[model samples]
Target: MKKNMGNADRIIRVIIAAIIAALYYTNVITGTLGIVLLVLAGVFVLTSLISFCPLYAPFGIKTCPMKKG
Candidate 1:
């Protein structure tokens, strides 16, 4: 898939995911809410790594800089 996420977007997602993981591990967030957040964090990391967002594709949202080509 074409990269729909820019460097800033990827970095932000990673940072947010890290924060969620830390909160979950520390018990600041627990139970069902924590589990849901943890899953979302995993998705964030995955999308960041690939620089693609499935949701963005359907919406035609692209944060990456346009190619000059």
Candidate 2:
């Protein structure tokens, strides 16, 4: 798939995922909510790494800047 996420979007996702991981590891988050968030964080990292977001596909959303002709 073409990259749908812009640099800023990808960076933000990575940062958020890292924060979630830190919170979980540091015991700042626990229980079911924490588990769920951690899982979501994993997804965020994966997507950010790939610069693709499946959810954005269906909506035809693209954060990437337009390429100059």
Which candidate has the top score in TM-score? 1
- The best candidate in terms of lDDT: 1
TM-score, cand. 2 vs. native:
0.94
Q: Can you tell me which runs of candidate 2 are displaced by over 4 Å?
A: none
Task: Quantify all predictions' global Cα lDDT against the true fold.
Answer: 0.99, 0.97
Give RMSD (Å) of candidate 2 vs. truth.
0.7
lDDT of 1 by residue, 1-69 (tens): 999999999999999999999999999999999999999999999999999999999999999999998
Please give the clash total of every predicted structure, in order: 0, 0
Clashing pairs in 1: none
Model 2: colliding residue pairs: none
Q: After aligning candidate 2 to the native by TM-score, how far in Å is the CA of 16 from where it should be?
A: 0.4
- What TM-scores do the predictions have? 0.98, 0.94
